[model samples]
Structures are given as C-alpha cells and as structure tokens.
Target chain A: MDKETTIYDIAKELSISPTTVSRGLNDHPAVNKKTRQRIYEAATLMGYRSNTFASSLRKQRTNTIGVIVPMLNSNFQSSVLAGMERVANEAGYNLIISQSLETVQKEIANAKTMFDNRVDGLLVSIAYDTENVDHFEPFFSRGIPLLFYDRVPEHKKCTSIVIDNIQAAYKATAHLIEQGCRNLVHISGSLKVNLYQERLKGFKYALMDNNISFSDACVISTNLSVEAGISAAQQILQMDPMPDGIFVSNDTCAVSCLKTLSQAGISIPNDVAIVGFNNDPITRIVEPNLTSINYPGEEMGEMAVRSLINYLDGASDVAITNTITLRSELVVRASSTRKGEAS
Target chain B: MDKETTIYDIAKELSISPTTVSRGLNDHPAVNKKTRQRIYEAATLMGYRSNTFASSLRKQRTNTIGVIVPMLNSNFQSSVLAGMERVANEAGYNLIISQSLETVQKEIANAKTMFDNRVDGLLVSIAYDTENVDHFEPFFSRGIPLLFYDRVPEHKKCTSIVIDNIQAAYKATAHLIEQGCRNLVHISGSLKVNLYQERLKGFKYALMDNNISFSDACVISTNLSVEAGISAAQQILQMDPMPDGIFVSNDTCAVSCLKTLSQAGISIPNDVAIVGFNNDPITRIVEPNLTSINYPGEEMGEMAVRSLINYLDGASDVAITNTITLRSELVVRASSTRKGEAS
Candidate 1:
C-alpha cells in the first residue's frame, strides 16, 4: 500500500533520466535489452509495483477475473474453487470470489457488485434455485464473457462445464443390479435441478433396461442433507419389505442412511447395498466404505477457468461451444458389493 | 465490462452541471434530499455506478478490503469466509480473496498482488511455513490496517482473532482422562502453527495434572490428513499395549482412525475413547458420534472483518488490541463415553 515506485526512482537509482527508465521498461527499440534488464531489476529491488489503474486507463484491461459460487464449505465446491484458483493464478489473473449462500437474492447482489467492480470476465456456479437470470443482463448487454460450471442453468449464450450426470447415475444403478438387488430405491435432490433430474432419469432407465418395474413410488425426493438421509432411512425401515439397494444423489445423505440402518441391525451388502455420488472423502471413512461416482470437481473447476481465460485472451471462442463434459467414474466399495466383486 | 455511466449523464438528463450532480450524490449540505433522491433514482435508471477511484482521489480511501488465506478447501476456512462475507457485504465493501496454498512463496506473491490492487485493508491467515513477515512490509509501511485470523503469526502491528486452543485441548484431554484413559495418545498436526503447538501443550498439562507422566513417544506428528489417520492407526496398533485413549486435532483424521481401528477389531469407547476437534457434521453421522470442540468459525470470521473495518474507519486501533480470543467448548458425545459419565 506504500506509494508505488515511479520510473524516476529507477532512473535515480541507475543515474539515468526518467524517460530512459520508462522506455527501457516498456521495451522500446531505442533502449537496449541490458538497460531494460537493469531498469526492471532496480524496480523490483525497490518493490515498485506497476500502476494498474494508469495502465488500465490506457489498455482497458485489468487482467483480473470474477467468480461467484454458491458456497465454499462443501468438499466438491472447494475442490472446484481450488482448481479455478490454480489455473487463474498460473495464467497471471487474480480471482475475486464471493458466495451466494444458496439464495437467488444474494446471488443477484453478488452479480451487481461484480459488475460495479469492472471485472473483465465472470465464472459462476449458481445457487440452488435460481429461477431468473435477468441479473446477468448487464454482462450480456456488454458482451463480456460469461461461463457456468456445476449447478448450471439452461442458458444458450453462456457456455457450461459439467460431467454427464445421467451416465454416472446409470453406471451406479447398474452396479447395484449386478450385485443381485432386485428391488432398489433412488434418493434424489430437488427435481428442479437439471443434475438431479438427469440422474433420476438414468436411475429409471437402468431399472427399465433390466426388465424391472420403474415405479414413481420408488424414488424419494429430499434436500439430500444428512438429516434428510436419516429421514429417508426411517421411511425405508417402515416399508413392508425394505429396499434391497439404495442410490443417493450425495454422500452426506448416504452416510446418514447407512448409519441409521446399521443401528437398526440391518446387514450391509447382504440385506441392503448403498451407493452415493460426488465421491466425497467421507465416503471412504464410513463404517462400510461407500460405492460412489467420482465427480471431477477439481478438473471441472480448472477447465471452467481455463476456458474462460482462453476465451478472454482470444485463444478460443467458448460462446460457440455449448457444453464441455468431463469424465466421471463409478468407484465400487464395500457398501454396494454383495458378491465381493472386484472393481 | 461496459462503458460506465457517469454523473454527466444524470446531470444532462436533469438539466444541471456535472459538479452539482456529483455533489448531490455525495450528499452535499447545499443539495436538498429531494433533489439528491432524484439524482440517485435517475442514476439507478441509467445503470450508473459510483467510481471509487475518482472519489478516493479526494477521500484517500478505497472501499475495498483484501483477504488472503492458506487454502479454501477446509471446513474451518470456509465457515470463516461465510462469516466475513456477510459482514463485508453489509458494509458495502468488496472483498478480494486469494489463497496461499500453504506455501510462503505463494503467500508473498498473494501479498504483492493485494498491495498492487490497492486494497484499503488486508486480512491474512498466514501460511504454515512463513518464517518471515518481510512480505507484509508494504502494507505496514503505509499504515494500512492488517488483521490476522486463525493461523496468525506473531506480529506486533496486526490484531488477531483466535480461540484458547490450549484450554480447548486441555478440556478435551481432561474429558478423556475422566473416562478412565490412563495411557493416552495425542494425534497432532505439525508443531509449526500456534494452534497445534498450544493444543500439544494443553495435552501435556492434562496428563501431568492426572499424575500421568508425559512421554514423547505418545505424541505423533502428522499432516493430519485422512491418509495420515490410516497410517497413524497402523503405528498405534503396533504400540506395546496400544494407548487406551486417542485425541486428534481434526475430525477428518479422527473419523478415519476410528474406522481403521474398528476394522482391526478395536471397539471405540470401550477399548479406546476418542476425541476430535471441530464438531463437523461428520461427527454425528459416524457410528458413535464423535466428541469434539465446537469452534466458532463463523463468529471468528465476522469478528475479524468487523475489527478490520473498525480499524479502517478509525473506530478501533488494531495496534493496541493485539489479540481477541473467542469462546470454544467441548461437546461430549458417544465416542468418548464408555461408562455414561459424559451424560
């Protein structure tokens, strides 16, 4: 925060004129490379910081990007943020991040703030239930590059980065069937989200493909929180014949369900098998390591920032690209294996 | 990213000079409130934004604060961020956050970037291995307010927000002792950080208070990651008689150790009462809920930002107030109670 060292300081240190130091630093043909190197060295030694505002006034670029995420507390979201941070930092861009706390109102406020700050581009992973995107009109009107990652909305002008949730879900459900589960249940998030809707579709399709009845009653919709997991397990316990297999949309809920069932004297993989999504670290620490879909959260984050920067630098036109899908794999563990099958 | 609207547009629409419009926006005593509200409404309609740089030319203050953390992927750090964001946003100040990724080199680079960005105030939670504070000379020289939270360094000019880690650890260790744990083992992170160091001291004091001689062999230093928990369990299993009690610095590692020990046929509570820190949601979902310290991460964040803003606005001086300690408590649960004493 101290006063930025000016070219005069550099010249004074080197016994030269301010003009020569500025020209040298700017790489003018008139100044030799040796002189430029000397000027740069002196500037660095004096802790001289380039006047970003003066340069921004002339070049109209800040070399900074803005990012808005729902929250940074979750393992998946944090992985994504770490990925974005690495790519942005390596590319000589700083990331200014804010969380919306899963509210549309807060998301709008964050968008307005980001706009007022004059960020060159934006990367966003939207809140839980964002019904309208009119708040982003200013960015669209100005043609500023905008990209979305996980929890994306259906927007044509904006590019999206995500994994194929449907395919991952299908593989997870099919793994349950391969373990000899005839009756299975899928615990889904709110149907409003495209991720959950697609995952539910995959679950139903897998059941149908195996000549099993895909009943609407088999799917349980909840917030997918740990408490929701406990409630889901309670509901399962009350059934005439408990579910033989369970696939949850997230790990937090699955862990809670597994704990509750174990407490009620239910045998895992023998009487019931379980699968969860996101491959969160908790999946491995549970009593029976949970089988789950390995979401590429970090990779998705890295890709989102990399793509946005590429578009900003004219290395690529991401707007023409609709969706970038990353790979997701099914990780089989003890929770969902009845036959002790190798994965 | 678009051309910013200025007071000139508002003045042109209202048939007034640009100077009068600007003065009205600044709430000049000469301008009536009705005229000021008119200008504000017109500015809003015209999509006008206040230029902090132009205003700072007269006021010498920027309505922006910078935050640097070691990483964004931890439960504690994210909770702190949520609290900071709520306070900073409510005060109409923007926060530019960056991660150090637990390296001193990255910390220095992040500090330089924050300085270059002309942040009005800075909040830092120093990296694990930052041996020197020279990187912060720029902020210190200019009388900029610098505050530290959580993993703070021993700096005179900076104010820090933290909990009594020693007391929290003492309490946790005392609880384990009360549960009849004689030979106790403390699983700790590297002793580089003050929190870990203080917690180790408290653990030693608890053992001494209980007439148990502290042995260096009972302490295991680790990265405190989930992988560390697995390896630590292997080491513990090789002990002469295996410690009767285990206390871990973090819940993630504690839960992993519990699972690994259980797999090795060691029953929790009955065999080894376990205690962990940071009452994360995982504590409840584990077979026997983990006993942990409920550290006030959100409150700590809010307090740090609030104090920084207070210092910036001349409402408080961080130089005089060196440290602010928040409350922390041990929440006893099933994991550390074999004889129902915790109840």
Candidate 2:
C-alpha cells in the first residue's frame, strides 16, 4: 500500500508553512480564496485525503448520523430513508444505516455499533418486538441526540416523530361503516407495537360509535406479510357470518388478501369493502384501487433528520419537545366505496 | 462533554497494565477469558468506547464500506440495499449510504464524500445520466476496491455484479412473440446507461430473429416513471396501427401503462400483450398479473458486497474476474398470455 499524503506534504510542495496549508485546506478565512483554491488543487492532484479521522478526534464530532430501521426494502421505510439521506447530505453529514430485521436483539446490537462508532446523532425506527428502550440508555447518558420515527418508544427523554395512527384508522373504519359494511374485521400486526395497538383502539372505537359490536374474533393478529394476508383471507372465508368490511395494517398484505378474496369469487365494495394503511404504490396498482392512510413516511424521515441536526447544532432542543406529530389522511378509493358512496 | 475513558483508565481501575487492558479489549489469547470478561465489564461500567479513530489511523482500515445508488426509495434499489446490509452486517462492517438522485453531478459529489470519509471499499450503482467513470478515478488511483451493481459502468479496473440484461430482454420479447404478436413496441430508459442499451439490443435482436423488421418508431424512450408510462400509452394509442405487443424496461412504468391502456378500453393480452422487467411485487398486484423478467436485485447486492469484501480481505481478486453475472428468468403471467397460449 502507498503512503497517505498529509497536509505537511502539500505544505512542502507549495513552499508554505504547515499552518497556512492547514488553514487553507480548512477554508479558514485567514487564507485568501486563490490560495485556498491552489491548496485544494494540490491536495486533489496528490490524492490527499482531508483526514476526517483526525478532524473528528479534534472536534469530537464524526459528522455522521446513525439510522436503524426495521427493514430497508419496504416502501414506507425506503421513502423515509430517501428523505433522511437528502437532509443529512445537504447538512454535510453521512448516514450509517442498518436494519434490525424486526428483532430487538439485532436492534440492540445495531445501537451498540452506532455508539461505538461515535456517531454525532442517531435516528431510529425501532424493530417490531422491541418492548423497551433500555438499549439506548447509553446514548442518553452520553447526551447524544436520539430521535425515533414511525415506530417509536414511549420515552420522555427521547424525542419522536410520528403520525396519528389512531385518527387515521378511525377515518378508515368510519368510511367502511358509512359504505354500509355491517360486520367488520381488522387485520393487524403485532399488538406489542404501540402503532398497531392504537390502530386496534381506533377500530373498536369506530365500531362502538357506529352501533356495531366489537369482538376478539373480529381482529386477526399477523406479521402482516403477503403469505399472512393470504392465510388471513382463508380465515375470513371460514367465518360463518363473514366480514363485510376489512381494515388491514399495510398495503402489501392488503393487496394480497384482496387478490385471494377476488379469486375466491368475492366482489369488492359490493360484498366486502377493504381499507389498508400506508398509501404505497401497490395500493394504486391493485384492482379496485385500495383506500389507505397516507402515512407521510417521507415527511417523518425529513422531520427526524432535521430535528436531530437542529438539536446537534444547538438551534433547537428536541429533548424539551418530547414528540412531534405529523398529519395523516385517509384516501378513499373504489375498494371501500360502494354503489351509493362517494369515493 | 465528559472526557472519554481510555485503556489506561481501565488498567488503573482494574490494577493491571495498560498493555494487558488493550490485549483484553482486542481479545488477544495472552489474556485469559476470565480476565477479558472482567475487563469488558469494567469497560462497560466506565462507559469506555474503543477508539476506532486512533485504531483506524494506525491500521488504515475504517471497517466501513460506502454505497451509492441512483435513488434510495425505489423497490429494486431498496431490496439491493437490504441484501448488502445483511452481508455487510455479518462481516462486522458499517455502511455509509447516499443517493445520487439520478444525476451525474450528485453522483460525483457522493463519490467525493465517500472518498473523503476514507471508506475501506465502495459499491456504486451509477446514476441515469452518468456518461463516464471519471468520478471514480480517485478510488482507482488509490488502489481502493470499487464495485458496481445493476447500472454499472464499462470500466476495466472496477468489478461489477449484474444480471444479463440482454438475455433477460430477449426472453421477455421472445415470450411476447411466441404469444402470436406481430407488431411490437419497446419502452426504454435513457440509452446512456449500458443496461438499457443492452436491453434495446436484445429487443431488436428478438424482432430480427422473429422476421419482424425493427424501426426507430417502435422504441419510445422514457425515464421509466409512472407518468412517463401513461404518456407512452397515449402515444401508443395514437399510432397508425397500435402495437400488439409491448416490453417495458421496468414494472413500475409497465404496470402504469397497463392500467392506462386498460382504462382506455384496450384489453390486456388480447389487444396488446405486455411484458415488463424487474419482477417487483407490484407486478403481482396489477390486474392480469404482469409477465416480467425476475431480476435478482438482492442477489446482485449480496454478490457485489461479497466480491468487494473478498478483495479487501485478500481472499480473492475481483479485478481479475471483471464482471459477475447473475441469472434472470422470465415469469409468464396473464398479462402476456393470449388465448390458447400456455402461461
């Protein structure tokens, strides 16, 4: 391997003092613009790296933000990541990203790695089964900024960004009821997650307000995968009375369920109205155009990054803010619109 | 901020030599398992973080890999990232990720950031408008391993992992021809990319082999966006004799085109049989389940990271191999299956 070029090497080549070269490289106003440009060209030509390692040690900042997501491939998470990358990049910070794969153990491991790496701040959307925020205690002790988005923990010290899942679900369930759906079922994810638990609450509240009875049999707890949706549809088929309305937690599962039920000779809206969460592109591609909650995934991501950066820059104290709630809306489509209902 | 704990602090706390503390932290065999466990517990109690900054400077390895993609929110790119993350995480490396936003300028800026961060290795999927590989010249000059996947550049010095786009396109087009289609149109992305250019070649070759003359008018260049697909469908509707078969470059655009055509009173697989590439989940959700080429995005990502890591680990020389091609298969479904045709 070749030896790395240092500012001292550029100083010698440019016949300038090492301090002048360092100042020029750092763009300290002490050096003129022309001299800085000359120093930059020399550095580029000599393959001189700016030595982020040394600078990070001196400044006690890595200029890197750590992001731990539940999964990387999902539509909502990916959109959130895109928004985060845009904000972090524009702020001259790099993102160190990892997925927990929906396990608390992996999330703990990922959090430890981010801490060991000395990331300036962290943005996390925790795993599905994470019951506690104890793993992040080290960050709080060190006074590192930790902000959670989407699936967040109920921690007073840590700030969070999220949409009102309960309101979104209530709107979806109400729309289905207004479409003349009598017996309704809610296909939910793990109840351990607060997001899904709140959604279940919304479902029950909507039913109670509409003079309909809610039962444990009406809720199906699933991982909310495509296969889970197919199985849930099979379960729906075996019901004696049958469900006239269905509110699924996500679009991926809902689309698969819709397809399976349609193949089984179920007429959409006319026989069974359906509503899904997360207005993913799949919602539109699916037949009948699924009604869903626009969860504002990208906006949540952007807000998370912006808040963490602001706290880090001392422009704002996110710790005092506790939580930031973004707006979410229910988009009604043909899937939940019966013959007499407006889409 | 409080001062960071050091090995000396741990040594003093445990009544041991700093050298012994370092060996225990590094898990050297000289330190017994019991002593190592004690050292770990003490280090944890004192909130001692391993100084990766100083260690990286001494070893010239950051234990980090940089990844640059055209966009972060796309289904294909996210899947690739998930695969990469799985492999890299198991290998004990962090990923610094960024998006180029489909511009050469942004790609260049991302490459420079990765370089400045002194990443041990880099994985890139070039932007749509990137015409040259000059931005990566710094990595090549420094002898740092750089690998490309999916939308790769034609550079001899860099290794790339990709699917055979030409063969995949040939299979898709040939399937449409076998379904008894005479007239055909190909939806394509920017020809500047080698991947799209090769697909165009395969589309032309398939027509030539089927005794169907190819013409410039048969190709509609697009960004492969949903809006572009709708506009392309409008253009197709205005043709003198509308195309009987269509092969789109990606599922996102193809599914949109299919929906637009379906809404315009055109029957799928009867008026115009359609085939798309990158068998994304959306393909299954679309009406008349889209026939597509199953591009292995996750596998491609895994291969790219594995190859680069292998090269970095001195286990194998990826540069000697140049390119690794993964297999892609054509999945025939209702969208491209005409009456009496086996799907």
Candidate 3:
C-alpha cells in the first residue's frame, strides 16, 4: 500500500501552515477561501483522504450499517439488497453486508463482525436454525438500532419488517382447495423459521376451514430446494392415493416439482394442481405458469432502510414501531387453476 | 439516542481512577488481571464501546474494503459477493458494498462514498457505458489496491480477474456451427463493455473460421435483457432467410429468445440452434435445456477476493499480475444438439 499523505505533506507542498491545511481539510471556517482551495488542491494531488474515522470516533457513530442475510444468491434477497443499497446510499450511510449461508454459526460470526466494526445500525434476516440472537447482545446493549426483515424472529428491542406470511399461505392453500383438490400436500421449508412455522399454521387453518382434517403426515418439511422438490414429488407418487394438490414455500422448489411431475406423465392442473410462494420470475416461465404469493421483497427492503435512516436522522421514532407488516397477495396463475375454474 | 458510555462512566461506577480503567481497557501491561476484570464488568454494564475508531485514526488503517458492482440482484454477482464476504470476514476486514445499477453517474457517487469512508482497498466491476474511469482517480493516485473482475476495463495500475470472454464465445459459436448451423446471429450486450465486445469479436472469428461470411447485420447489439431478446427474435423472423443459429450473451435473454421462437413455431436445434452465455440455473430449467458457456462465477469471485487480499497481505504484487484469466467451457445441451446428443 502507498503511504498515506499527511497534513504535513499538504502543508509543505502548498506552502501553508500545517494547522491551516488541517483546518481547511476539516472545513473549519476560520481558514480563508483562497488558502483552503490551495490546500484542497494539494490534498487532491497527494491523494489525501478525509479524516472521517477521527470525526466518527468523536461522535460515536461509524456512519456504517451492517446487513446480515441467509444467503446472497437468492432472487428475493438480491432484490431486497438492491433496495437497501439505494436507500442507504441516499442517506449517506455505507452498508457492510455479510451472508450467513443459512447456518447459525455463520450468522453468529457475522453478528460479531458487525458489532466489532462499530456499525451505527444493524439489519438482519435470520438463518434457518438461528434459535436465539445472543451474539447481537453488544449491539443491543450499545443501543444501536437493530431491525429484522423477511425471516425475522420475535424479540424485544428489535423492530421487524415483514409481510403476513400466515395470511399469504392461508390464501394460497385455500386457493388450491378451491380448485377442487380433494387431497392436498404442503411442501415447506425448515419448520424452525418463524415464516415457515406461521405458514404451516395457515395451511392447517385453511384445510380445517374447508372441512378437511389435517395431519402431520401431510406436511413435508425439508430444505426448500430444487432437489428437495423432486424428492417431494417422488414421495407423492409413492403415496397410496397420490396428493391431488401441492403447495411449496418457494417457487424454485415448486417449479422443480412441476417439472418432475410433468416428466412422470401427470398433467398439470388436470391430474394435479400446484401453488408456490414468492412470485419469482421463474413462476412466469415455468410450463403452465405457477400460482404464488407475491412477496414484496424490494418494498420490504425499502421500508426497512427508510425506517433505519429516518431513525438515525431523527426524522422518525422507530422505538414505537415493534413490527411493520407489508402487504402480500396470492397471484393465481394457470398452474393451480384446475377444472378451468378461478382458484 | 442513548448517551455513549465513556471511560469516566466506568471509573465512576467502579469507584476507580479513570487512568486505571483506561489502562485496563487498553490492556496496558501495568493493569493486573483482577483490576482488568472489574473494569470489563463495569464497561459491559454501562454499554461501553471499545472506541476502536479512535485507535484506527492514529494507526491510519480502517480495516475496511469497498466493493462496487453493476447490479446486486443478478445470480452471478450475488455468488461473487458471497465468496468475497467469506474471505473478507476471515481476514478481519469488513466489506462496504454499493451497486452502480449499470450507470456511470451512480458509479461515480459510489466511488466518492467509498473514498469518503476511507476504505483500505477497493474491488470494482465497471458499469455499462462507463467509458472513462475518472471517478476512481482518488484510489489510483493514492496507490490503493484497485482490483477489477468480470466486466472490467483495461487499466495498467489495476489487476483484473476475469474469464476469457472471447474464448468462451468462440467455443459457444463453434458448438452451434458443428451442429450444422450455416447462418448465425450473435445476440450481445452493449459494445461499450470489453467483455461483450470481445464476445462479439469471437463470434465473428468463429464464423470466419467455419468458412461462413460474417455480416454486420448478423450481430444484434442490445441490452441483452428478456425484452431485448423478444425484439431480437422478432427481427430474426423478419429476415429474408432467418438465421440458422443464435448465441445470446446471457441466459435470461437466451431463454426469452427461445420462448419467443417456440411461440412462433420455430423448433430449437432442428430449425435454429440456440446457445447462451452464463450457464445459469435457468438454462437447465428452460424447455429442451439451453447450451451455454459455463462461466465459473463462484470461482471467479473466490479468485478476485483471494488476489486482492494477497496483494494487501504483501504475498503478491498485483502490478506483476495485471490480468488473471479463468477458464470457461461450452456446456452442450439439447438446445444446440441437433443429433440428439445428451448434455
């Protein structure tokens, strides 16, 4: 690395007092405009960096926001991050991002790193097996604003931004039932997550409301992935009476199931109906299209960042808002429209 | 906001000398273990931050890296960032990321933000239409390590880690020609980027090597979006004699062309062979599957971060290795296999 240009270098090169150069660089009004301009030009030529760390130290604010997510490659997470980058950039805050890779240990490590970095705020979406957030105690104790979005856990001192997963799932399941599905199956992600747990509750509630008795056997709890979807389809085929309908927590998995079933000569919406969550672009391209829950990932991200920045700028109070729920709707496409009827 | 706890707070709470408490916090040799423990407990109870920022100001190293990318929502870029976060976290450095959204103006703002933040190093993938890199002059002049990957520009002082786009495009085009494609059309992104420009050059070279005359009209320069692919397909249909082969720069656009052509009753491979760059998951999910260039996004990401960190650690000189190119291959699938060859 090149040696950093010090105030002494700027002072010597510009033939100005070191104190004057320092004051000019710090934007002290006592420095004359012409002298300040000369100092600034010399500083630019020497590639002098502003001493922000010193100011941040004095103010006890890092001017940085930490973001932790389950993984970085998913479409939902990516869209959310794009929105976050926009809001955080506009608010003059840098976003330090880390991925948990869906592991609790990694999440803990990310939390520690973020805390160690002295971030002014933190935004998190918990990983699959993250049962507790003991690692974030430092941030909480320091009174740094902590916010959670998407796969969030219920905790005090943490404001959460999420859509009503239960209602969305309930509407999806009810739509499948309305499509004349006699026996239905719900392919879900790990039940440890609040989103999946609430979604499962909604699925059961929908089934019960339609005079259908639900059992633990009907729920296939797995890591919602493409391979898992194929395996779920194989499991459905082996049943004594094949499931007439299937609803997966995510579109990637659901599209895999649709493909696998189609390859097995089971016609979509004719012999079986399917509904997926997260209205990802894959839903539109998949054969027969897919019915899914239109998750507002970008909107949720925008809200989360906007709220965090607003609180930081003293424009709003985030303490009073414990949880902010966004709107989500079921997008019924051809995949679940069995019997040529609206579901 | 809660008031930040200071050394005075810990001293007052523990009824100890402020100097002694500060010494304990700084791990001074004079401070005994028992006294240090007492200071630590009081500090924790009072929510005392370590004030590393102050220490860093004196040391002149912030231990932070800045990263700039064209877009954050793409699968390839996300995988790259995931790999980067892993390496940076283990190295005890934080990554402050920003997206240019493929605009030069945003790229300039992101650079200014990174500069103002006083990051230790920078990693960038140049945005579309970013013909000049005046925005990065501060980092360049300061001798800070500026590493580029993927859509990088030609710069002497910077190290670029990228796959050979020309070679990859050559392989893809050759595969189509081998499958009995006489006339070919290369659907590519803007020529403003070196990557797309190289790919286009390779396509023309492949045509020349295959004894087919390359025409200016055969090359369709576009944004390489799904919408662009639809227009490309429409243009192809209007041709006097529709091209017998098509190779698109990215998968989303390739899939779009495939869908549009299929809807127009043009059978893939049999009527017009199609190939795509970037073997994204969508390639496998698309009907008949897409033959594509197997670009190693994860490996490229890992290499980029590893090189940058190595340069920072003094293990390697980036100037000595101006450009590091990774390998890319053609993954032949049903989309370009007219002879019924399996992938």
In terms of DockQ, which candidate is stronger, 2 or 3? Answer: 2
Put down candidate 1 lDDT per residue, A1-343, tens digits, no spaces: 3566788888899999999988887789999888888898898778776676667657767677888888867788888888888888888787777888889999999898887777788998888889767888778877778888878888777789989988899999999999999899999999988889999999998998998898888999999998999999999999877889999999999999998898899988789999999998788768788999999988998898889888888899877898999999999999988887846
* Model 1 spans > 4 angstroms off: A1-5, A9-15, A23-47, B1-49, B56-58
Per-candidate RMSD, Å: 2.8, 1.5, 3.1
Better of 2 and 3 by TM-score: 2
What is candidate 3's CA lDDT for residue B266?
94
Worst 10 residues of 2 chain A by lDDT: A334-343
What overall lDDT, based on C-alpha atoms, would model 2 receive against the true structure? 0.92
- Name the best candidate (by DockQ): 2
Give per-residue CA lDDT, model 1, range B1-343, as digits (tens): 5577888889999998898899998899889889999998898777776775556545656577888889877788888887888899889887777889999999999898888777789999999898768899877777788888888787677678889999999999999999999999999998988889999999999999989999899899998898999999999999988899999999989988988898899999899889999998778767778999999999998998899898887898888988999999999999999888664
lDDT of each: 0.87, 0.92, 0.88
Docking class of 1: medium
Output the number of the TM-score-best candidate: 2
Interface RMSD of each candidate, angstroms, one decimal:
2.5, 0.9, 1.9
DockQ of each: 0.52, 0.84, 0.62
Say which docking band candidate 3 falls in.
medium
Q: Which window of 10 residues has the lowest lDDT sum in candidate 3 chain A?
A: A49-58
lDDT by residue for model 3 over A222-263, one digit each (tens)? 898999999999998888789899989999999999999999
